[model samples]
Target: MHTPKADYPLSEIRRFLEPGPIVLVGSAWKGRRNVMAMGWHMMLGFSPALFACYIWEGNHSYEMLRRSRECTINLPTVSMMDQVAGIGNCSGRSLDKFETFGLSTSAGGHVDAPLIDDCPANFECRLVDERQIPEYGLFIWEVVKAHVRPDPELPTTMHYLGRGEFMTSGAIVSRRDEFRPGNL
Candidate 1:
């Protein structure tokens, strides 16, 4: 026997709907550079490697990203949860997040945005479309370059569950044999 289900509030649906890893979005315009914690993003394509993320118009990084037309997605490990939450709670307009958080960065090869040196993986991307920004605040990007650490000791990542909760990535389970070559 199973228990009956109850409907949750519409506003609380995001806790269950959002299930992707959190990322630090880095952008640069003029001489200013900023990094913002972002949990609303997803992969759109595979062959060319495309991504889409939503950035509110009021965010400090919004204008910088729009003006520069490029950004970097830095994947932080589970251990960096405190910094991730801290970055999301504050605006990047007044303080330099990199310096405040003691983050190190390196220049991206294909874009002006700086990649977070502490992250195990960083993707350099260029904005490809903004047709949905007015209605959805969505930005589509094409990944131009990808950098990763040769070996990661603490590779666990975190996924937000709304509010102040987060779920850490755990053991890997693969179904490689279940898929055909063409499907992969």
Candidate 2:
């Protein structure tokens, strides 16, 4: 069964329904560092590389990001699945998520937030705007810098559905390059 609001309700609509990369936002405040899983991210522009990700107002990571105006968005590989779930389930306010998940971190190029070393790719984001909605807030940012491991094969990225369910876009399927010169 489906309804119009399946993609409308901010709470009921399943987040991460669109399969993509698993982005972990690393943020720090004072001396505390926290990382959280976020899937509601998208590229809003290209020239300046503007991006936007949704954050719940109540989340500890959200608070840190709102205050710090800086974050590192890490794209984890398939090998880091368990650690990814641990970060999403745990609260940074109560637990040091980075340590609890056994994730290692390094400084980003432009932000103070630590970037997860396990991830194949990382994006350093600087806050551009924070728009408050009814329940969730959207943090608009610009991709200040980026880093990618020099590998021939790309790593699989994870995505979140609802209720702890996740999926990974595995293998490459392409028809764009498969076209042949044929008389149609």
Candidate 3:
């Protein structure tokens, strides 16, 4: 028999409909760089490699990102959960996150931001639209360059469940055969 569903709190809906994996957003402006943990990002398109992420105005990196108009999106794996948590729980206003966390970085090819060297994948992005920033803190971007480590085809990533909890990505289950060519 199918299980019965219970009404859930609207605020806690993220635990069920999480967007994507938690990522470390790298931003820099005028000689300063910062890393912020973010989970509210998603793939918005494919042709121009467009992406969107929300950043509250109060965030330390918000001003830098707005002025720099570029950033590097670093995808951290499950192994870096502790570091990810540390990055998220602290503010980048007072200290250098890279030095505090011992995160090594490399300069991005297209953007002025630093890419976390430990991350398996890093995407250089340029701000494309900011019309939603006033109404919503959304920043649209176009990925200009991307680099990935090839050893692990699929790396396990963390998904935030709210309330200081997280879920790790599990085994892959593909249904390629069930989808039409255009849909796949």
Candidate 4:
């Protein structure tokens, strides 16, 4: 009934517990725009559409996001693996990522950041809290506007496995009948 376990390093913990898909973050400031791949974000609430993410200070987009106070979070599907890896491996300070990766973009309704035209979903966010930035490199944002591609409602998403690896989304399972009514 039980399997034996062995010691594991804490640094590799994210390889097992990484949350959510790798998203491309779009940010614009002072007439400049850039897109960077991000994997450290998570949803915090539903009512106001709150979410949180960590962006290191060394990242070029960090200052842009801090100053602009807005950005677009774009979700890519499994087919976009090349673009995802390329975007994350390169720096925005050198070249136009959208052009380099052959990605296209469009303007969002509520933010100055550009939304990836290729993504199935995009969220325009506004920074709601800056308290954690200096100490934690964390940003709290409220998604002000959201857009979705109507077709293919359930697109397979990619998750980071760390050490240059990934795990793709798989089949769905439902237990609605087994859940408490209030919990739903």
Candidate 5:
């Protein structure tokens, strides 16, 4: 039997539509460095590794990213959820999130941005296009360098469900042999 459904408001659709993982964006400009928790991002392509993220004009990191033209996407594990929520609640313009959250960072290989040492994976990216900023506040980037932990297994990551709620990544089902060599 089919279950009855109730219509939800348009504003609530994001809770159902957003599927990307939450990430900490690390940016630096003119000797200032900041890390902001972000969830509005998606992968655009595989070749050359493209990513697109929306940064509202009001965000402090927005100006830094615009000026530096680079950033590092840091993937935090579920254990760091408290810090993630804390970072999102505060503004980087007023307080240094790195110092507040006690996060350690190292210089990125290809970009001036700093990578959070606590994250298992860090992607260093440079802005490739900014034409959509005025209209959509979108910034497209090309990943220039990537760093990952030596472990073969991945740690649990979280996804925001809006209203201070988040869902942690669950079980994985592998079908590696189902795909042809060139198809992937």
Candidate 6:
């Protein structure tokens, strides 16, 4: 039997996804961590090193992150499009996502979290403060240590919006080489 699939305009979807190319954030509690595909995250500060990620309290990853007060922000490249979608679709409570999805991870030292393998970059963080808004349960954490892959030719970041939508970052085709005169 053949059935027609509902379709929506691509422009409408792009309108909702405001930000672009966001790093994926993951958290763990006792070797059981969940990956949250998010677009609502940003760097708060530099010296003190603070980062904020907005997540719904009801989400499995949010609860785990809140309780543990730590997370590993893993930045995946364009190649991991499928893996990102897989993690986002399922919940850790029902499935051992890492094992089922064939995702690999390493134990973090400073934070009791698992570092997502195959990601281009990863940051180990600890929760500094949390602001709860009924609108969207938001959490802010501080980055403690960062890990970069040995390979330097990795692609730019990848991000996901609501639904099963995602987009990989494009290259900086045109940009000023330097801002300061002697910076180069």
Residue-level lDDT tens digits of model 5 in 105-180? 8877688888888887777889999999889999998876667664534558899999899999887777879999
**RMSD (CA, Å), each prediction:** 11.4, 10.7, 10.6, 10.9, 11.3, 11.1
Model 1 segments more than 4 A misplaced: 1-19
lDDT ranking, best first: 4, 3, 5, 1, 2, 6
lDDT of 2 by residue, 19-124 (tens): 4566899998888899999888877665476778888887899779988999987878778889888888879999888778888788775899997877766777
Q: Look at candidate 1 and tell me the lDDT of residue 121.
A: 70
> What is candidate 2's CA lDDT for residue 37?
90
How well does candidate 3 score on lDDT at residue 175? 98
* TM-score of every candidate: 0.86, 0.81, 0.89, 0.88, 0.85, 0.77
lDDT score of model 2? 0.73
Cand. 3 Cα-lDDT: 0.81
> What range of 10 consecutive residues in model 6 has the weakest lDDT sum?
2-11
lDDT of each: 0.80, 0.73, 0.81, 0.82, 0.80, 0.67
Candidate 6 lDDT over 81-105, as tens digits, reads: 7877777667787877788778788
Off by over 4 Å in 5: 1-19, 175-183
Off by over 4 Å in 6: 1-20, 133-135, 161-163, 173-184
For candidate 4, lDDT tens digit of each residue in 3-46?
A: 22223232322222234889999999999999999999877776
lDDT of 1 by residue, 1-184 (tens): 2122222232222222234789999999999999999888877766466789999999999999988999998888888889999899999899999989989888877899998877777788899998988899999988766666545433688988997999998876679899998654
Which pairs clash in model 6? none
Deviation in Å, model 1, residue 92 alpha carbon: 0.8
